[model samples]
Target chain A: MRALSKKWVALLGVLPALALVAFACGGEGEEGETFKIGVMESLTGPGETYGTVAVQAKQMAVDEINAGGGINGRMLELIIEDSKCNAQDAITAYNKLTDVDDVKIILGTSCSGAMLGAAPLAEEEGVILFSGLATNPDIANAGDYIFRTSLSDALLGVDTGNVLWADGIRNLVTITEATDYAEGVRRTTVEQFQKRGGQVVGEERYPSDTTDFRTQLTKLFNENPDALHVAAQAEFAGGTIIKQARELGYDGPIYGEVVAIGTTALEVAGEAATGTKAIITDLDPANAKGQEVLTNFRNRYDYVTLPWYLGSAYDNVYIAAECLKQTDDDQDADGFRDCLYGITWSGAIGDDYSFDQDGEVVGLANVVVEVLPLAERTQDNQGYRVLGSAPAE
Target chain B: MELPIIGDIIRLSRDPKDSLRLSRSNLEFWVNLLIISWAVAFAIWQGVGFAITVGTVFAIWAILSVSLNLVVGFTGLLSVAHIGFFGIGAYAMAILTSDAAYEQLRTEAIPTLGWPFFAALPVSVGVAGLVAVVVGIAFNRFRDDIYVLVSFGFAVIAFNVFLNWRSLTRGAFGIHEIERPAIGGWVFDGELEFLALVLVSLAVVILIAWFLMTSSFGRVLTAIREDEQATEVFGYQVTHYKLAIWVISAMMAGLAGGLFGSWTTFVDPNSFVLMESILLVSIVILGGLATIWGSLLGAMAFVLLEEGMRFLPFLPSEFVGQGRQVVLGILLVVLMLFRPQGLVGRYKL
Candidate 1:
């Protein structure tokens, strides 16, 4: 009984500390006076590069809007939470944002898994969950409330297949990381490529976080295909796969998805990254609005060299703010969602921004880019040279 | 002056030997009863939304932790592949109740066998038990350290199967829109309803564990854990005892997994990883090995800690993402240094 009492005492001692902590962090804006928006991102995990840059881009948009005297004289308060690129963490973050912070609309989720995991919850709660960069094909019909600013993996895969076939690469060998994002792209690419009278000679899959791809690459190279299609979620692994394939004496062109069109691939693969082509959704660097956003992003975050999700994230904030402006009641999630669906605004990346019935970005164009060697790459170039653009439809 | 049941419970709590037995006590039993009652009442009063949802998850974890304790705590097997059974159960329930399966069956013009949650639950548990029997037979030749390695290896193999088996498991896209447990025209769809179901399941599992641990069979298992060679000399078939308990524990984990999948209405490979198995073990060790009550306490504490650490004051916004894990790590180290036997454990690791 004494021991039991002591245990009770210990538990009692811990409760106060928890209460204090909760009290300290519990700060909400004045009710109904400001437009409260929740933001979820992988702020500290492997996907931190995209997440941190996305936050910066959103902040930049928010700053611009506030400087223009706010959204119809009402302030926009952004409550950001870190998802850590894990599904469980994403759920916890979502619950905290909805229950504790009491935010109506959420903009998130750079990672596909995080976005998909939280989609059901958002739908159940009748809140809008808009993603800036999640590209998994499953997310298209995840929930009515779920939407993304990025193009779907299915469209990107079709475009990639077209690009490969146009380049006279008839036979292909593919290596994909075992994830929703990578596998979705790989499956669709194979399907579309096969429909266009091209054959996938060999295909290999490796688990996520696997740095060693020699065994899979060796098996793939044995097919002696015209090109190797690498679908990886992490840019570093994509670059490493290309370098390892080169080391194994495969001199054919390498193809990748949007995830590979970054400095990580160039720096990690070195000279081997040269001539590697990828499909990306960012605007042309030469475009005025694109160059302005990129310049501002570069100045703000000196470490981020690539405009990966910067333009999309910047555009998402502006789009959400625009939707909030049209709503008579800022607290009405349904009204905000309806307004978002009806929007057709021009943004930095495209001449017109709109969403289809499925809430995916409509008329989003995919640009094919190639990696240039270090000596040929410019300061603002980040090693990727745009080759051509494909219709997103 | 004490009432009949109340007097008996007090007497039980006062005696150390009686307390060590699996019987209920006045203080401990009432405390747990009150906690559970408070949780239900709180959910009801608070409208059964987010907190109840989180509580339902905690209940499922508690069940898994208790089930794992049967192997790691009572029997000292140190099985690390428990989540493999968890995955199997979740996948089984998912496949049985999934609308995706109906779509596939329609393509073949075959009638859909979209079984209800209750029907799938028992099948999932049975499947996990059968798999455990196979694994136990394969690894019965090995002992101790080798058993641990084989169990760890099993988890890796199971995870890879869950990942690459795109035809059945749908790979990383996951099986979505799983039907909740329902009767004729009545579904346990609300958070409070699910919480009630989970609590009932937890109570049954705890009662069964208590009954088993108090029996002579449980004593023999403990004797084997203390000294296997000595127990073998006493005419006990140690391998059979270990294998039986392993299968039973695995089935319990499967049952918990089924409940979890049904409640979440989704199942994916990411939920059943090696890290989750490790967390289950930590819950058992942290709560108190060799004590069923400890498993419950450990699970609740772990969940609360994970959620509560997010609210820590004065943490820089940048560090908030990783700070919860850091705080948990520091707490675990301090606990290990101070109370290696665990917070409520009767035995030391």
Candidate 2:
């Protein structure tokens, strides 16, 4: 038995070293055949729902660009690595792309935490990290190399605060998930609300993985505030919060951010989700290109969880392809960044949205949308009816 | 006839009369030397970025695994709270080193000492050790499975503190752009330099673990592991032994966490989740529980396996992430079937 265990130990010791050699030898890839851009996405873990959509949308755009003669006659290939919606995996994904694959430009990272985790490394290495889904306000200052198509939660907070005051909500109560993105939304919105002299009656927080919010909800209801804000990291949490709030007999007006107003959240909350207003940057339904992108995405994937992120992700690929065309080199991160700074384009996300000096998206504003009745939900609008632009602060 | 290396290792702590066993163990030591030399050579061959990134990661995991082996493998304690110490160390590093990383983004001012890395690292390790001592004193009475449950509770509470302590940890948004270690004149900004620093730290940790394992104290630990009641009846204070080893193990894990935050230049609550603690336990288990070298080998294999899955060009990109997890599960199942004592473990949990 001892001898056999020794053999197993020897085998285990030799195997990993052998595998390393094999991996090292096989690391090289054919150069100049494709513009290999890295895609660091949360393809698994808590962010998978929207993350999967982001990946599919990017792939669809990559296929389209390749089919239409590639990025300047070289095929555009994305080396997708899952970040798993955390810092550790994001750093690992970033290192693999930059060190092993040697890609200069990376598009993705679905969650703000993942983006934040990888941003410092990208900034230090002079690699361009562009995201379509990450929306923490702090990302605006991450570095020159970090850019995103998503609107900053700071802007969303502003709109949300304005909408609250406009709707005559003076005293507000909040139940927020303990996460970077959710906290950003809650903090910034509260800042704006307090600046307008709106009093916050009660506040509660729950961890990201937690499902039970009854105690927190009871505490908030006891305050009997004029309005309640549900800031959740995941859609299920948002749905459950709304469902439970109704079950607790709090018929007061409830508000939330884009994730809370998502199709899946509404599906989870069912009838309870109706009349819940959200501040979100949504696509204009009448825009031809936007409709085309949405139609094609529906046709290809047969489902859309976060329509805006899909649009943003699709636009990111097109934007990247255009930058590659202008720079004429896949490795020229500087030239690509300059192209982003100089160019303005109309896309599915918005008409002629350009990046500011800080690489934050400009020319796009958030809107207030209300969840429709459960039976009235559609795949197109994701069960929400837009109530026009959010009132400006 | 006994196998040369295994027989030597098995008899290493006993039967000092076997000169052949000594010679064979020396050969095993040389083999270990050769393996490390090959790794360093490979790193040198693979440019600065790959070497620094992978090497630093390997160093971190190796430190964590080896130290965990001291508690779980040597002292017969199953600790799920090692990652809590790691997180504490990481947060200590972040809070001490930089302020602008999150201060600019946050509305409220979070205190940042902005101290140098080396200066702050000791405090981080000390804090982890202190917490471990406190928890050890409280829970040392409960042995077996109850100890595991209590330790698991510590990990969960630590995770919650990291997640909800907005003033201290910046909550989940994470502190980014942490400063690298620097001396008076020069900053260790280069990847190769940082990798070297981490490896040196890992070596120090391994040395400490070795010194502990070879001492009379180590023999007592083994005795305790073999039979706690017998050890206590022999007039040995088992709780003191357990607490001392636990503190040392936690401090080592804390040191690794500090290096990890410095390497990535980022720290967040998500990285220290219960799943990560479970992953650490898996690393110790896979590498072989009572062997320091096994921890090193196990970390290398686990890191390689996870990273190596990406090298397979044939795996469809869509299923690659899930495929990696599946392959790891299958490997563990196979290893359990073949080697129930782990790849080189002396004791079975």
lDDT of 1 by residue, B85-189 (tens): 999898888778876442432111112357899999999899999999999888777778997899999998888887778777777777766779888889987
Per-residue error for B84 in candidate 2, Å, reads 0.3
Interface RMSD of 1: 5.4
lDDT of 2 by residue, A1-393 (tens): 456546555654654565566565555675768899999888778788867888889999999998899977899988989898888789878988998778999998898888988888888789999999998888898889899999988888888889999999999999999887888899989989999989999999998777878898999999989999999989989999999999999999999998788777888899999999999988899888888988998898777768888999999999999999999888999999999998798999899889999998888888889999888888877799999999976
List the TM values for chain B, per candidate: 0.85, 0.87
Where is model 1 chain B poorest over a 10-residue stretch in terms of lDDT?
Answer: B102-111
Give candidate 1 misplaced runs (Cα > 4 Å). A1-15, A24-29, A43-49, A82-88, A391-393, B1-48, B101-113
Q: Tens digit of lDDT per residue, candidate 1, span A1-393? A: 567545554553464466455564454435677788989988866677777778778888888888888898988877788876756667768877887667779999988777877787888889889988888777777767888888888888899888888888899999998877888788778877888899999998888788988998999888989999999988888889989999998899999976665777777888888889998786776668877888887786665544747888888888898888888455678988888788886777776778887788886788888888768976577777888885332
Against the hidden true structure, what lDDT does model 1 obtain? 0.78
Winner by TM-score:
2
Clashes of each: 0, 0
Per-model TM-score on C-alpha atoms = 0.90, 0.92
DockQ of 2: 0.43
Return the TM-score for chain B, candidate 1. 0.85
